[model samples]
Target chain A: MAAKNGSEAAEEHTSSAEIRSFFDSAPPLKNSLEITDKLKEFLDKNSLSAGDGRANRIVCVTSGGTTVPLEQRCVRYIDNFASGHRGAASTEYFLKAGYVVIFLYRRGTCQPYCRSLPADPFLECFEFIDESHIKVREPHSEAVKMAISDHQNVVEKGQLLKLPFTTIFEYLQMLQMVATSLRGLGPHAMFYLAAAVSDFYVPWKSMAEHKIQSGSGPLDMSLVQVPKMLAVLRKEWAPFAYCISFKLETDKNILLKKADMALSKYKMHVVVANELSTRNEEVVVVTGDEKVSVCRDKTQVGCDVEDPLIKLLVEKHAIHIVDSCS
Target chain B: MAAKNGSEAAEEHTSSAEIRSFFDSAPPLKNSLEITDKLKEFLDKNSLSAGDGRANRIVCVTSGGTTVPLEQRCVRYIDNFASGHRGAASTEYFLKAGYVVIFLYRRGTCQPYCRSLPADPFLECFEFIDESHIKVREPHSEAVKMAISDHQNVVEKGQLLKLPFTTIFEYLQMLQMVATSLRGLGPHAMFYLAAAVSDFYVPWKSMAEHKIQSGSGPLDMSLVQVPKMLAVLRKEWAPFAYCISFKLETDKNILLKKADMALSKYKMHVVVANELSTRNEEVVVVTGDEKVSVCRDKTQVGCDVEDPLIKLLVEKHAIHIVDSCS
Candidate 1:
């Protein structure tokens, strides 16, 4: 049986050669496979699989910010300063340490370093400013007209980024769906709420079915709270996921106090504190226990802080960590 | 004075040689300075202040799914299959266009490509799922669980791809604020409504500030139409900004009828249409005036449809277009 056929040996030789050539060429598809294989190998070499009962080490990370929709006519949205560098870097450390991570990221936040966008939706950029005529004031009319003319020249010559939005309510509805889905994954998970969720949503009253003449009634848009999503998360979904609240304060005492209060109110396991006004690179990680305090070095301005945080989490949990520091 | 200056020059020369030698032997700081200069040069060459307004083109990119929050937990939160790819990719395109793009994103959507989370402020990614281990059971439970679990694992493993959001209300709030800011710029602006903004919002019974516990006397969440925002934009902010709305339909009659309705109601210059089930690279661009109908190459998976859309907008407007095509 061992010496059955020369053809079998020949086929095996050809297969090995093909594999070698494919690896040598390093196609993108092949590269992905190689990376996947490496990860699998790492997971396998050490008992990182859920079957090994290590899957219980789950961490859910929510990064980026939220939008508040006040009305169908006008909305109020603020981009959180979350670059996702901290979350991404930290998660890498968590995975390396054999923990499962669930990332709840806001749209338009950070993506994988190598992830590329699709290539068909030919996008268009434009500036829609219309300056056909300018109102003539008495003394400053000539100067104002000249400035307007000059500005028109620039507008006619340049392109403007066109972004489309219809109503604030529409935007908010979408976030609730994502949050609801996240709430379903059951407990044994940890939520790293790093995204900047907006505080206000606008409400439109008596919105027009057609474009109102430019100068219509005082056209006031009303705003309201973003339906207290954090509160909802605490009450409804908190039981299924470990919650971690963050307080970015310009004042030191307020930061610590808020963190402490959050710990009590939300029953968070860990609370991280830092100064929003200062540009220094130091962070204090506060756990629910109050006794666990860890300080990490300030990351470089453009560097990702995710890795360090992950390291800290892994160290605290005593989980098997991956050695890929990169 | 000449003698004293000559002595001073001699002393300076000695230190200058030391500095030059240090740069030659260890050029990290020097390299950083060089890179900074390059960035400044690029900015100067593209900024309006630098005489070249190539980089001033603005792309108002939106991200994240919409959310509809309820005062109490609801049977339905109003949602869709949007992963926020449309908005996120558009944002990246706007940034690449050398335009000062203001991203009007939703909560719980994917984040923009280049954002930074500081360590000092203690940014954390948390989920409410791991709190008390609430189990999920519903018709949408399996799908929702899978979505959340996948995101959770990726985030926990330190992966870069993460989707953020839970409902549509938050998404709308984010868009409204951005729209107001862009509208303030007055015309010369472009808006792209690629996000799947919901047509309905959750109706609440009351705004009581009390915990809504499970088994609380047959709770109910009502649904109501979300007032059309496109109409509001045209009436309140038109001539300041041109609008584009997306119409995803399963039938051609509905698509055309809705397109016409949107055009007449919102006074939108363009309406992008796609089949409700259409995914991947396939899409249809429908203009309000029938000026042009363009078909693009099949969209590559994971890429963006924004490029073609941006191109069309620029061509039709006869304005300069900025992009990172490569």
Candidate 2:
């Protein structure tokens, strides 16, 4: 699986062989086998083995920040800015839209339906009503109750499965396992690439074994571009699955341009473009044919932009499934 | 407060003037003034204005990892590896030792009594007993009750104060504010430096105003050393405060050497040294007079190393207080 020798290609464009080599050279996550087995078992019980003639539409929602380790043991890392709020919020909406949600998230990031709570939710949300009894605080009681019920309802129906990862290596490995397992589902599978993945990383073979010492004057290191796996995902992993990737930029001038490039270059079905400052308020969904603006409803108390975003994606996914079947 | 020109004398050695200059040149935290005022008020009420002859001994425990932003708008950052488990666990022990604790921690990191809870504690700990009533799950009920009461007890007594920061700028600014505020307490003040602070950063003046464009060939940038603030803390900020700093290393051969260097260079009262792999199981406490190996007790069901660690520190602090008076 390693790339052909002397394969240091241009930094901007990475070939499939280079991408494969990147994965081949990196050490596999300790729990990759266990996680793959769990994913297979989940799919079998929830979709494949079900008695119903029709299989449920399933979407993999990747959330939070993927860290690029500078060392093999990983004392330091480069991280994209993300709290997993968007992914977690979107997972809840996806479940509401009747899609089986595989929540692949960074460990300790925000969780679905728990986004509305305070940072230290458990400590701040509960109070001792009496000596022996404790109850949710009055101000947070309604939200807590609703979140619990909604979460429990999904769990009881076996519609939500959560898998967690911390580093870029773990995330990519798990993503591959998920995409391969979903291949049998054909067009019924969807990929929501919401996680903030790092664009560059220190290759595992050249990384320092111990913590990088600060005593050595200035720290100088070179990082290689992360292989564009979107192309491989579309071409080889799960060809018929509808994939939507996200593009977040601080500069509005280049946002749509990058999204368009991603759509064309990776053969992505759609790209969700968002500005770093205004991501919560609005987004632009760029497809091969059109660009649609999505905004949160100001009139509603808790309406999120994800409501409309997921609705549009589900509609597009439905059409794709039907087109493939015909 | 800026250092004199031509200040870059040595890479590893940072003068106090240079450290102060780093703060002066960097952008102040948005909430520094407000946070300082709050700290002052809290200290006044809890320690300075108490009617009894004795003032409360106060310790500031810093936890979690500080981030170094690669750009001004900060779409990406370099992060240190820390889950803050040790610091959070240590806070509970400090409170049990009858000292007021000001927990200065990275946002979203673990909390003192909430250490053992699940990642999404509130969501996982609660369930619907029936249609209208939600209650804590049976298995977690006892723990939930204990955590809540213990947290509330300290909160009500004004013994615990939590201040959260994310970036290196915020962490350093807040630490300075905290140290200066505790200056009046003399020997009664203690500092537990547990936060995994970044070793290098791009100065705010030189950082890109927007998200760094990945289109540029390879990211070639130079990061300046983060000015050593421990020396400033000991010499100027709160001279009489008993200070303990942590030294975490991946190589066991150099662990104690680095700890000793930190102790001598920064004039710290103690330095806790541990290897990354065995940090949980054992640690070496390095003081000027001796080095002691502290290990977790195997006989106790739930005994943590922090329990004994805090006890030793408290005893050392008490002696320091008495020594100062003599």
Candidate 3:
């Protein structure tokens, strides 16, 4: 990546300082010790020695949207829009391509392999034939079977690690933890950051202790910028890891520009750009020298864009791996 | 219920005007016609007329939290804290008490009869024995069966009608539709208001069209009070319907006080008061002449506060039905 311009370099420096203070002021994670232990265990089991020809490749795939709490006890929150579809679908392909996956996701968003199942309640997918017997309804049985089998395969092989988060604080902290854990893998480690993180937040110290009262006329609140973490992730946290990010826009015109900016600013290997309306059907993969648009096969009955998107990314990741070795 | 005080009365009047303007300026519901039709069909089938003493009591139990969108296309939203547990559990109890229920709930929140089932993905609760065969995991089999059976019973009998909402706009609009449809059921109708609604919102007309841009320094947004819908529900929509609302507070001292205020100002028949910490263990039911504390049966392995809470409400509803006829 070319060196940052003077203004951009200054911005990066400021952001680094802000990131430090943000973490310092933020409330400690509720189960940081347990999370660290889990990450260590996951990596220990998956990371083969350097001389092993068939060493497992590691990819930390972040999915879903993060929440910014409006109160300390959290009766209210500001949420970003994400269903985790891209991450979940891509995880399946990453597993198919023989990568050990660490799936960090928001608690209630979509899950890998289970996308075909009824969105929760999911009561519609089951039926009681007798007083004591329940079974998947006939129409849903095949889909349920496929989802279970797929999930079970990776789970039994211990190739997938799932960690859930809710608030932006938890999400960023956990991401850093995962990144730090995978740092030793160098270029073999990939970070597929698809989570829609909050742009702004109420600093924990300044957040309201109780629910904001309603009877008080109009409500005015100021939210500080959520300190940029991507730069630090690239430069400090896991410097040698292959990084991929996403840029989603409602406007088609600004989508590519934003993706380009993200690629440059974060020093990401690739930035996937998708317009809000057409995201499911297609996405443009933006790298330093190319912008490749990938689309689902419209003629195929069940094929989705993720199928081809992950394939292309897998190829790019191979080149990154080879270049790093040389 | 007693009359409102002077300031309370003035606030109510102002709120009524605000409600009108709020609805007038709000974006039209995307599926208003379909919602109206569903409500009508539900009420028509369930409402058995005046002379039938065995007429099914119709209670509209609303559950979960409502969101206030930050943008017109909605990249961000302010959310209230509720899992819809109260509503879901209470709906099961209401059904047991022979009430035909109209469950207006937030999408993806808790569901009645689903209290036992594993939460979604729920992939953990299923296993594949072979490539084509899947079954509920052994540990979760009984729960899956019970959930399926109980849900099947309700579906077969058509005793419950569920309508889902996400945004405050959709919630209020659909709620109004349900209330209007239940207007003919007078004394037989009940409204159990458990949804944690937003206290404030950005007016639709002024909301940004695209995702709010970051990096422009602190974000300052002004949100107007979400116009109270309770007063209109009680007075105009379903004039003689028996109403039960909830008051949840973090502070124990203010719990009953806020419940009392809500009861008088909204002229509700009962207000269930719960502290944030102890809500599932106990609650205080505040009425015109009573402040009854109901606690869960700790001695019993599976008993909950909702079991007693709903029983008491059912008896009170029976009294309400008899008194209204006299």
Candidate 4:
């Protein structure tokens, strides 16, 4: 909490105590029971009781950006700009690879199948035939058809479970809950951490009760470093899960170095290192042994690197299952 | 830009000079020319040369929240939580009252006609019949039809000109451009300012080229106060326009006092003071002479206070036009 402000941020609090204290001081989720119930239903459907030849592989994909609220009532926040495009695209690929995907995303961000449509003009893309009937406009008709059919099929078949979080507190808590819930799947469960989560936050108990007044001169706020929950997720919550974390940087020189640090420090199975300018075109996968550059087929129109990236990960997860069993 | 940090925020610079310096230091707009051309076309379509009995009234409605980027490349930002419901609703009322609206908004915020649609599951709202046809699902059919028809009609006729912005730099530049463009309308122009703008910002010149590396001790940043452009707007840019600014506060105790200060200091014709919790239920119209409480009819099921609020503002604007001519 703000009790130990930024100056005292990382000097103390062993990983366990930090995680425990962070959760202890956070405002309890308004709908934790509902989220838990939904997770239980989702897990029950994918349970081994189905008697399928092999347990269905499940992957939880976290997407979009998390906020750091500055007030208890939440008038202002610290945020990041993430279109959730990579996560959405990756989710589509994972589902196509026959993985049941839990899409943990920020509300109102880009969704798994709706990425092709124009960001604006949601209503403009349809022709109003009548009060009850509307036809999709050309150029958009095929995209709309594919999006709805694919989305509906996955959601109805219970292959995609969507959970949304906004604040950093909600994100970490939900991550813990999801990791723990998927614990029984062992090596079959994968955690693809793609969300741009806040690194620092003003703890709930220390937040202002009302909107911070302006014209009050330079606002000096003491934001505490958010506890590194990746360590907790790998070590305690889902030890057997194949975990992949991401590192994005504007400086190419420092990107791989940071990814290496995160890989070793958090014991991440693989760290996807991407630079800001060329993220969509290429990325480097950093693991214990080597770094592999994954690039899109630029010669082809509308080709995404996510296709190959997810395929590669699926293969890795398959190998992981074998390694764990042996 | 960061030459004078928050400590020297208010020490110097006349209102006009502050505005000048701010604009000079800001990053140039990527599409200023396009925005200007669109604004010109919109204005010319409603020009007085059409020999109409009276000049067409036009209002620039600024909506949603602006972001303050923490770095030059902008991996992080300070933002506020705003649904943009009030501004969107008010634009509809303004258009209904026979005024053309230039909706300057944050990209991806709510739109005037699309408010009733579900925030998530955009694709699920439609039933895919075939490649070319889609039917609106029941319970949403009527809303979709109305939203599409109304939005299309306005946009096609050029009655609603929507300009979107994200950062504080883009917002202020766009506002200045819109105001200066409408300067010819005189009292027929109205400025409805509702966007939750940043009060402090990391000056562009001083911002780091890359993301601020964490693991560094308590990130100490000296944010400069954003130059107040309201004074410049009233005294220089659109002096004769009927200006209405909004004040939103969490504490009701200081709301009116803040509103009064804004009214006198900025010479605003009306300052709409709204408390955060009760904003939709009621607001106090603060002006030179009096403060009047305006509330929605609690008896009605789907009533909104914006209807009555816009009606009163329109009446007041009419009086201002008459007074301006004399």
How many clashes does each candidate structure show, in the order listed?
157, 0, 0, 0
| TM-score of each candidate structure, all chains considered together | 0.37, 0.94, 0.94, 0.95
User: For each candidate, what is the lDDT?
Assistant: 0.42, 0.84, 0.83, 0.84
| CA RMSD (A), model 1 | 27.2
Give the clashing residue pairs of candidate 4, or none.
Answer: none
Screening candidate 2 with a backbone cut-off below 3 angstroms (N, C-alpha, C), the clashing residue pairs are none
What DockQ, between 0 and 1, does each candidate earn?
Answer: 0.02, 0.36, 0.39, 0.41
What is the lDDT for A182 in model 4? 88
Kindly list the per-residue Cα lDDT of model 1 for residues A82-155, writing each as its tens digit: 45545545554555566655444554444322111121100101111222211222443333333333223322
lDDT of 2 by residue, A1-326 (tens): 00011233445455778877889977878987788788877787685533222348899999999998887788889887799999999999999887888999998888888878877788888886766688788888777877788888887777898999988888988898899888888888999999998777778887888887775244555666678888889998999889999999999999999999999988999999999999999999999899999999989999999999999999998888888888
In model 3, pairs of residues that clash are none
- lDDT accuracy of residue A113 in candidate 2: 84
Ranking by DockQ: 4, 3, 2, 1
Residue-by-residue lDDT tens digits, candidate 4, B38-110? 9999988867223221348888999999998888888889899888888889999999998889999998888
Over B198-245, each residue of candidate 3 has an lDDT whose tens digit, in order, gives: 888888888888777675366777777787788889999999889999
Decide which is better by DockQ, 3 or 4.
4
Tell me candidate 2's fraction of native contacts, as a decimal between 0 and 1. Answer: 0.35
lDDT of 3 at B211: 76
Model 1: residues with Cα > 4 Å off, grouped in runs: A1-326, B1-55, B72-80, B96-98, B112-177, B202-205, B216-218, B250-253, B291-296, B299-304, B319-326
Give the number of the best model, judged by DockQ. Answer: 4
